[model samples]
Target: MKYCAANYQFSFHSVNMRRMNDLRGIDLNLLVVLEALLAERHISRAALRLHLSQPAVSHALGRLRQLLDDPLLVRGQGGLVPSARAHELAGPLAEALAQVRILLGPSGFQPATARRSFRLAMSDYGAMALLPGLLRAVRKIAPGIDLVVSQASREAMTAKVADGEIDLALGVFGQPPEGVHSTELFEETYACMVDAATVRGLGKLDQVAYLARSHVLVATHSERVDAIDAAVAKVGGRRKIACVLPHWSVAPALIAGTNLVLTTARRSLAAFEEDPRFAVFDPPFPLPGFGFSLIWHDRTDADPGHSWLRERVIAVAAGDEPDDAISLRS
Candidate 1:
C-alpha cells in the first residue's frame, strides 16, 4: 500500500501520544514483539519468532496492552484475533519498515546510463601526464559524463575532498589529513630536458659543464635546489641556478629554445613532445624519483560511479593505451 505523508504524520503522532502517557516508558523493542504478535497471533509462536521466552513475550504483550489501551490480541476459535487497534497500525508500520529498507539498500550505477559531473584537482604536470588517456578511456565507457579539472593548493585540498567540493586529487604528495584515502598511482623518474640543438653545441654534460651552464629549477614549496647540491656534493659539483619557477609546467616553455636544462617527471615530458626543440635525457647524477597518487574522501569509497572513475585514473597512470581491449595501466 502507498503511504502518503499525511498518513505517516498521523501514525507517528499517534505513536508519540501513547509513549507520552504510557506505563512509565514504552520499550521500543515492544514494536518487534507487537509485529510478531500480530503476525503469529499465538504468544508461544510470537516468542519463537522474536527469539524470546514465552514469559517474556507474555510480559511484552501486557505492556503493549496498557500502552495501546487495548487487549491487542483476543483468544478466539481462530486461535488469536488481532484487536481493531492492532489491525489499524498494521499498514502504516509495514510501510515504515519498507522505507527504512529502501534507504539502506544497494544502488545501481550505469555509466552509459548516467550523466554526472566529476570534479578533480591536480597539478598541471599531473593533468598533462594522465588526463588525455583518462578522458579518452572514460569517453569510450561513458560518453555523456563531464569532467571539471582545477589546480588546488595543498592547504585547501583535504578540506575540498572532505566537503565533496572536489571528487578526486592526483599529485606527488601523500598522507592526506584524516578521513581521506590515497593510493599510489605510479613512480616517476626525473629527466633533464633541454633544447636538442643547444645540447649538441654544448657537448656532453659533465659536472663542470653542468655547473657552467644556466639551470632552471621548479621551486614550489621544496628546497629542491639545496637537495640537488647535497646529492652532487660527493661528485665535486655545483649547478648555477639561473631561474626558480613556481610550477613544473612553466619550465618547458622557459627552456624550450634555450641551453637551460630543467629536471621534471618523464611522464610529464609528453607535453613537450610536439616541440622538436626539446629533448628528455637521463640526469648524469642520481636524483629523487617522485611517486604520484590519487586521493579521495572515504565517504565515496563504495559509490559505484566514483569507483569506476578511480579505476580509470589508475589505468591511465600505468601508461595504458585507452583504445586497446585490455588497458596496460591495469
Candidate 2:
C-alpha cells in the first residue's frame, strides 16, 4: 500500500499529543511503580523493592497497563516476563524517572543522615586504586551510604549509566558515548610488575627480554586486547602470553612464584608496593597510558546526591580531602 508522508507525520504528532494529554491525568507515581515492576518482573518482588503492599503494586500495575494500553507483564514458565511493550518502555521510563529526580533538586540529599545505595561500574584497576580511599572517606563522613561495585564493558557502561542502573562509571574512556557525561579523574601511566626474585635474576628488563619472556595479561570486561599488546605492536615486538586473568587483584598471587611479567597502571602498584614478592619497573619500550574519567548520565548531573558522590570520587582519586573536591554545578 502507498502512504502519504504528510498524513503519516500528522498522525504521529496527534498520537503523541494524545498520549501526553493522557499522561497528565495519570498519577505520576504510577511511573515509579511501573519502573520497579518492569525491573523485578514480578508483583511481589516489585512491591518489596518499592516498600509497598502487594495489592498496591498490583493496582498500580493495572493502572499502568491501562495507561500504556498494553499488558506490560504476564506470567511465564519462569514466574514472570515483561511484554514487548514493557521492554520498549523500560529504557525511556528509567530515563524519565531520572530526569524527574534531577528536577526535584538537591534538597533531598543529607549525606550525614541519609541511607542510600550507589552502584558503580568500574574495572578491577579502578576499584583497587579508588575504593580503599573512597571507603575510608565514606565511613568517616557518610557512614550510612553503601556501595555496590560491578564491572561492565565500555559499551555496556554507557547504556547502564543512561538507564540509571549504574550511578557512575570509572575507567579510561577516550571518547564517551553520546548521552554519557564524563570528567577527567586523573592520568595513568603503565608500569611493569614482576616477582622480586625473577627481576633480580634478569636485572632491568629491556625490549629483548620483555618480548622473550612469558607474561600474564589482565583483561577487563569484553576487552580482548590491552594497552600492553598495542604498545608492543607499535614497537614491532610481541610477547608470549602465558595466562589471561580478569581482575587485577589476582595478578599479584599469579605472578608471585612465576616468571610471568604483569604490566598495569602505576597507581595499582600501591596495593603491592611493600610486598616482598613484587618489584615495579618502567617498561623498556614506551607504553601508551590512559586518562581515567568519572562517567555518568546527564540526567543525574544536577542531582545533589549524585553530585555529592561525584565529588567524593574525584577527591579519592586525586588524593584530596572531601572538602576540597570541586563542584560540577559551579
Candidate 3:
C-alpha cells in the first residue's frame, strides 16, 4: 500500500514539471510581437512600428503559434481575427507587461537624499548666471550628488540633449528638438554693458554715444552678428564689433578695461551690476527678450535623478524670489 501511494505522487509531480518547462521555453520577444500583432491586426503595419521587417514579424508569429499550440491569428474577410485563446491571453499579457514596466522603470529620485552625478551643457554665461544658485541649492539639499558641467556649441546643444551626451542644457534657446522637454526658467531683456572707466572718462552715452563706442559681441556662429545688426538698425546705427567671444563669462573680463560695450541678459550681468568698473544700459531698441530654459531628453523624463536635477535647476534659475520683495531692480 505504501509503494502504491508513492507511485501516484511521483506521476502528479512529473506532470507539473512538464507544464513549468513549457511556460519557461516561451520567448518574451515573441510575446511582444504578439501584443503588437493583436493591436494592429495587420502584419506589415506592426512590422514597421516595431522597426522589424515584414518577414521577421512573420517568423515571430510562426514561433508564437508552435509555443501557444493555437492558430493565434486567423485571416478572415474582415482582416486578421484573433482566436478565442488569443483574446483570453491578450488581457492577462497586457496586464503583466504593465506590471513589468512599473517594476523595471526608473527608480523614484529624492533630491534631498539621493546620490547621483548630473551632466549638463551650457554656455559660460549660462553657467555663471544660473549654476551658482543651483549649486547653493544642491549643497544645501543633495550634497552627495555631483554635477558635471560642460561647454557645448550652439549647433551641438539640441543634438547633445537628444543623444544623451548630456543630461540637461541651460541657455537662451529657440524651439526644443523632437524627443526633448523644455521648461522655461526665466525671461529678461538684454542690457548693454560698458566699461565704467571709459564711460566716466568719455562721459555719459546717448544713442549716438552708444553706437560710436566699440562693441564686443558674443557670436554663437555668424547669425548672432546679424541679429545684433538688425537690433541696432532702428537707431540708424551699426556697431564697430572689434572683439567677438563665444561666451559671457569671458565678456566681463574683456570689457573690464576696454571701451568695448557688450549686450547680455540682466541675469547674466547681475553679478557685475553693482561693480564700480562696469556700466549697464538698455539697448537702442529691444534686442528680443529670449527665454532661458532647462531642457532634457524625453528618455530621461521618467528617471528619478534626472527629474530631481531638472526641478532644482528650474527653481533656482527662476529666482523663486519672495513676493514681498516686489520691487524691480531698476
The candidate scoring highest on TM-score is 2
Q: Where in model 3 is the C-alpha error above 4 Å? A: 1-107, 201-204, 222-226, 321-330
TM-score result, candidate 2: 0.78
Reference-based TM-score of each model? 0.60, 0.78, 0.62
- Screening candidate 2 with a backbone cut-off below 3 angstroms (N, C-alpha, C), the clashing residue pairs are none
Residue pairs with backbone overlap in model 3 = none
Q: What local distance difference test score does each model get?
A: 0.72, 0.79, 0.73
Per-residue lDDT over 241-262 for candidate 1, one digit per residue giving the tens place of the 0 to 100 score: 8898667677888886678877
- Score candidate 3 by TM-score against the native: 0.62
The 10-residue segment with the lowest total lDDT in model 2: 321-330
Give the C-alpha lDDT of model 2: 0.79
Q: State which candidate, 2 or 3, has the greater lDDT.
A: 2
- Model 3, residue 267: distance off in Å is 2.0
Off by over 4 Å in 2: 1-27, 36-83, 105-108, 201-203, 221-223, 324-330
**Residue pairs of candidate 1 with colliding backbone atoms:** none
**Which candidate number would show the highest lDDT if scored against the true structure?**
2
